[model samples]
Target chain A: MGRIKLMGLAVSIGKVTERYPFAPVEVPDDYRGKPVIDPGICTGCGACASACPPQAIQVKEEGEFRVVHLFLGRCIFCGRCQDVCPEGAIRLTTEFELATPNHDDLHQFVRLRMVRCVRCGRPFDTYRHLVRSLREVPFIEGERLLLCPECRAKAPLDWLEGGGDGNEG
Target chain B: MGRSTLEGRFRVIDVSPDEVAEVVRELFEDGCYYATGMGVDERPLNGRFAVYHAINCPKRGVYVILRLTAPENRPSVPSITPVLRGAEWAEREAHDMVGVTFENHPNLERLILPEDWPDGVYPLRKDFPYNRKMAGTEGTAGVRGERHDEATMSVPLGPYHPLLHEPEYFELYVREDRIVGADYRGFHVHRGMEKLAESRMTLNQIPFLAERICGICGCTHSAAYCQAVEEAAGVEVPERALYIRSLMLEVERIHSHLLWFGVACHLLGFDSGFMHFWRAREYVMDIAELITGNRKTYGINLVGGVRRDLSGEKIQKTLKLLELAEGESREVIDNVVGMKELIARMEGVGVLRRKDAREIGVVGPVARASGIDTDVRRDHPYAAYGDLDFKVPVYRGCDVLSRFLVRVDETFESFSLVRQILENLPDGEIINEEYSLPYMEFGLGSTEAPRGEDVHMVLTGGENQVYRWHPRAPTYNNLPAVPLMLEGEDVADAPIIIASIDPCFSCTDHVSIVDAGSGRVLWRGPLLEGVERLRR
Candidate 1:
């Protein structure tokens, strides 16, 4: 009798398994899958790199550009990079079919052009990052923003005291 | 008292090495049980190595932690295995991981590390690098089979068996069809997570690392770890966050229990029941994915609170799914209980008496099944468990049937608890990001995992890192009782008896039997097949 009832229940529940490769399964809207970075809005500040638990996201300086690399192989899909992104650039999409034969396919690199300091002639900050900073602090001169943080700090006090020109310095 | 946390719910006491046994014994006499013990290399902090024993005192509703520090030059402490048998594995683990000597500990050999691992180099020490790789010593690997008496035949269950989900070795000494003695050597999948958490992972990042401890009950570990850090840092998590946490934990419990039921049914040769139980479990998984964005490893827990919030729509959907899950789970479990043949297989088999249960310090369904009324959720409530009303179902049968029945009842209880949490969820912020980390402050966080009580101990270090983080999975406490359960039982029932405790080995690995007297391989195949051959 119990077996009869179990058979009835099984008949009612029929099949729960899905044909994954043959059929497309719909994931929820908030499904945490592979995280991708929107290069246009990314400021190359390395917040995601620091916030990532597995150190999957790495930021490195390569001569003229600051490259933010997100390796899919090491990613735990924790979606922490999305949480800590100041610019809301990194987003976790519902695309989780991330298998690949080529090793390079796992790497997602976003390269931002680095701006050289006017005085020191060394790349310091990304151009977009400096521009974004300029928007927040409008009182600071654009020329002052052009100089790297080190060059700006080392500059004399008279340069800031002067109203418009460098003549006073 | 050294320090207290969570409104004096957890108290730390400093004790000298000689008094360790006496103090633990006194606590045991006062109705306390050994939760877990850890050895920490505290030379960077106090120029001494420390050993902490966390004892759960249920009557007082407080966790009493006894701390004993040994000087760096001679790091040794009196072993508490004399007072409590449950402390044996933990003491041996401490010795293996941190190079701390447990004086007078019977059979204090290497427990966690492999035999090939080089001696005198402790991985958990401050001087050791997290990513450092050591060369495996020559010719130290392979089986060190202990020969039993000629009367009893030695049958090995695992290092990998199809019956087991993970890699574990159990040598059962059988006399014809009945078993006399058993021995276990596990920890094949130990990933050195504590070392990684202390060295590389920061405060918030360790939650994800903790979640990876067990694939089935990862959220519980993460929740325990987060609670430990929150207690250490004195972070006040919002009320609504607590409710959501409780909701997710209950969801995890329901799914985990269902999974275990399916496994048990499979072991009992009831494959149809296994399929049905897992089919019902899909609803709970769907609910989890809808809320936490994943079926397992919810990844919702953070240090201050949770990362995700439950919306009204999501809550309604979750409730609908919960209804379906509850109904189907009830239908399946009720059918399973009514089957007399299945009941016969489980009943009067794998008997672990109440006294043995308490002495071994088992927790969760196994302890409850054995008449030990202990649940960390009720005793020392963390998250929203304090606000929720639930009955801890216990059975005195002290057999495999009791364990199954306990889980069945607990599954229904979890369903009701989830409903309560979802309905009464407080409306406010989900996270409280404002908190400060106190350096070198000890905190203990415990959660009643599906298997048993999962404990995580944390010592907050400067620069957003834990100085020493030790997580004791429920299996660590419960695995010791398997040999006792296997003794004097039918050798064919060995797989079900071992599976009855819900040993979550966290990795897959294989088993063979060797002749004890002749030192020859008797059988080398799946444990079930070996059992069949032995029966014939």
Candidate 2:
């Protein structure tokens, strides 16, 4: 009697398993899988690098360019990069089967040109980052916008010390 | 007077090194269970090494933290293990990580680190390099295998057993097919996570690292860490965010309990029950993916609020899945309970008395099953638990069956909680934007993880980094109770009894191994076959 009842219940429940690989996998709407980066919008600001818990997304400066490296192995797929991205360039898409033979294949990189400081002639940040900043906040523009943080802050102080009005700049 | 954090949840008391044991003794006599103890190298900040013992007074609904300071040159404090049996592992861990010496500790050996690791270098100290690559040591320098003894036979279980996914060594001393004594050596999965949190990550980054501490209850750990930081910073989370957190927590709980149930069934040799339970568990996993994005480690938590918001459609979808899960789980549990063979195996096996459980300081279903009525969600309300009403299931059976039943009941309770949280979720921002924590602030946060109470203590540091963050996983408090549970059980019932605790080694870096002193290696290969031979 017990065996019959269990079988009846099991039959009534029906099949609840999903067929994947054979069929296209079903993921939720906002499923955080592999993060896709749009190089066009990516400024190489290193916000994602700072925000990433595992240090998976790394922003490395190579002389004149900033390289944004995303190591898929280290990513816990938390979507914090999406939340913290100022430019909305990085988004987690529904593509999570990230297995690869080579270790380097797990890494995704985006390179951006470095923005040199106008006053000091040193590479300070990415050019796209400066452009994005200029477009977002227009109040701090003109000569000061082209300079790095150190040069920008010092430019006004230098003008003041050179017997010129600070407002002249 | 020291600064107070977590509002009134934790009371900090700072003392000199000599007075450490005295203070802990008083707290223990006053009925406080040792929650966790740690040593911190404060040489850079205060030119002294500090040791903290967090004692939870459940009855008073408060945690009393005993902090002691020893001079940098001689970092020594009196051990509380002599008085409180639960402080044994915590003190040894402190000794291993921070190089702090506990004067009267019975065994002051390396608890977390490999025995071959160089002495006088502590990984957790401020000046130690976080990412320094070192050469691997040759051979197992300190693999303490059990030596031969006359009357009793030693049975070795793991360092790598089929029963466990992670590495843990357990030596069980059995005499004529009955376990007399059990010894455990673990911490294989310790990836220096706390050190990584301190040096490599910012405040925003730590949550993700915290989540990965245990793949099973990753969200709960992240939530607990976030709550600790939020408390320290006095960040008032939105009601909607709190509700969302509660909902996700419930969803995670249901899935975890079901996962444990399936695993328990497999251990009991009930393959069909395991398959059915896992099938039902898929629905809860679907709900989690729908709400928080991923199935397992739902990365929805941030310091102040959740990263994801629940929409009306998401809520409706979750409700449907949760209902399905509840129905299926109920059917499966009812059938399993009615089975005479299953009941007989679980009913009186691995019996843990209420008095022994309280003394050993077991938590979650293990404690509840033993008739010690303590649930962190109800006792110390966090998230949206204060707003919601739920029963803390208590069973006095004090056996494996009672533990199983407690988890089964919790699954249904969690289903109702998910429904209530969705219905009552307030309208507001999910993540708080305008909260800043000053340096030197301390806070204690405790969340009732599916296994038990998981507490995180945070000391906010400079440059948006935490100075000291200690995450006490539920298994840390519960694993100590296993040996006591295994005291007089049949040798064949060892696997099921150990699995009854629902141990998550990744969450705790915890494990057990049983070895017989006879020349034969019991754990040579194929654990199931080895157990079968032993059974015969």
TM-score for each candidate, following the candidate numbering: 0.93, 0.91
DockQ, per model, reads 0.71, 0.57
Per-residue lDDT for A1-169 in model 1, tens only?
A: 5667998988886776789789999889999998999999999999899989999999999999999999999999999999999999999999989898899989999999999988899999899998887776545465677777778777776656653543210
Query: Any runs in candidate 1 off by more than 4 Å, and if so which?
Result: A141-144, A149-153, A159-169, B1-5, B139-147, B507-536
lDDT of the candidates, in the order given: 0.84, 0.79
Q: Model 2: runs farther than 4 Å from truth?
A: A1-4, A11-16, A101-105, A119-123, A136-141, A149-169, B1-6, B16-23, B134-148, B510-536
lDDT of 2 by residue, B173-192 (tens): 77777888787777876878
Native A-B contacts reproduced, model 2 = 0.60
State the TM-score for model 1.
Answer: 0.93
**Real contacts recovered, all predictions:** 0.72, 0.60
Q: Tens-digit lDDT track for model 1 on B1-536?
A: 11112556689999987777888889999989999988999897689998889999988989999998999889988899988988998898889889999888987988878898988989889899999999988625645445456666777777664454356788787788688888888877777888888888899999998887877788898999988988888788888888888888889999889988988888888878988988889899899999999888899999878899998999899989988899888888889898898999999899999988888899888999999898988888888888789998989999999999999989999999999998898888888887788999998888999888989999999698989898888888888888899989998788889889987765210011211112121122355444422331
- Candidate 1 docking classification: medium
Q: Which ten residues in a row have the lowest lDDT in candidate 2 chain B?
A: B511-520
Error of 1 at B381 (Å): 0.9
